[model samples]
Target: MRDNYREELDDIRGCLVDMANSVGSQLSKATTALLDADVTLADLVIAADDQLDATRESIEQRCFTLLARQAPVATELRTVITAMRIASDFERMGDLAEHVAKVARMRFPDSAVPQEVRPVFLEAGHVAESLVTKAGTVIAKQDVEAALELEEDDDAMDRLHRQLFREVLSEDWPHGVETAIDITLLGRYYERFADHAVSVARRVVYLVTGEHRINAAG
Candidate 1:
């Protein structure tokens, strides 16, 4: 019975890793849809978010079941609880990516991003993708070093976000009101997506070492 319970815990962990991977893939496609203004692809991304929702729900159910049945202690308790928290973050990440796809779909034929700032958003997308993938690996291995490094990776996204503000706020900006709103919203979605991934990594660090590291920004 004890051996079976341990296997169940491992299965729950596996589910969380798969959830992270799915969110990362969705983010990649969502960014492509945003940059190219592909409404069809955007629509696909938006609709598929339900998959993430289901994954999170399944994870939560398993976690609660463990808490009720096994009464997991110490690291085992942390494992169940942190899986729930990380799964929530994973679900929110999906929602952020969906927000980006919605903006791309709303603009339809016209690209949501103007040509001048196209490179900035493209870079944002790249960084967001990299952060989530790295976050997943940290969870899989519970590597405190890798988990700590996510903050630095997130810094690159922050720099790009501020760069976006400079572009939009400039007096000579040509995109005007509607494009400005799109760009602002798009930038936020990317930034928040990365933030959620960072949160997940922090939780993983806490689960492994029992110390929740403070974020420099916080």
Candidate 2:
């Protein structure tokens, strides 16, 4: 029975890694859809959000069951609880990706990102993708050092987001208010996506080291 219980815990951890990977894939597709104005790809990303929701539910249920049945304590208890929180973060990340896709769909046949700031969105996409990928690695290995690196990776996303605002707010900006709104929204989506990824990593850091780093915005 002890061995079985341990296996169950390991399974839950594995599921977290899988969910992280799924979120990364969704963000990547949404970025492509946004940059290329591919409505078909955007629609696919929006539709696939349901599956991410289902995955989150399954992960939470398993965590709850373990808590109720095993009454895990100390590290084991932390593991179960952290899994639930990380799953929630993944769900939010997935939703942010969906939002990006929706914007692409709304401006179908024309890229939501204008030529002046297309590069900013593109770099933000790359940063977002890298953060999530490292997040998956952190979950899979519980490497506190790698988890720390995600914070640095998120800084890149923040920089890109700020750059985007500069482009929209420039005195000589050529885009209309509508396009500026789209750019603002898209930048926020990427920034928040990176935040969730960092949140997941911080959870892992706490799980491994028992050290909690508080985020002011969180």
Clash pairs, model 1 backbone: none
The lDDT values for all models are 0.89, 0.90
Query: What's the lDDT of the predicted structure labeled candidate 2?
Result: 0.90
Estimate the lDDT of model 1. 0.89
Candidate 1, residue 217: how far the Cα is off, in Å: 5.2
TM-scores for all predictions? 0.97, 0.97
Model 1, 61-172: lDDT tens digits are 9889889988978888888898999999999999999999998898889998999899999899889988898888998888889988889879999999999999999999
- Tell me the lDDT of model 2 at 94: 98
In angstroms, the error of model 2 at 43 is 0.5
| Candidate 1 residue 38 C-alpha distance from true site, Å | 0.8
User: How many pairs of residues collide in model 1?
Assistant: 0
In terms of lDDT, the poorest run of 10 residues in model 2 is 209-218
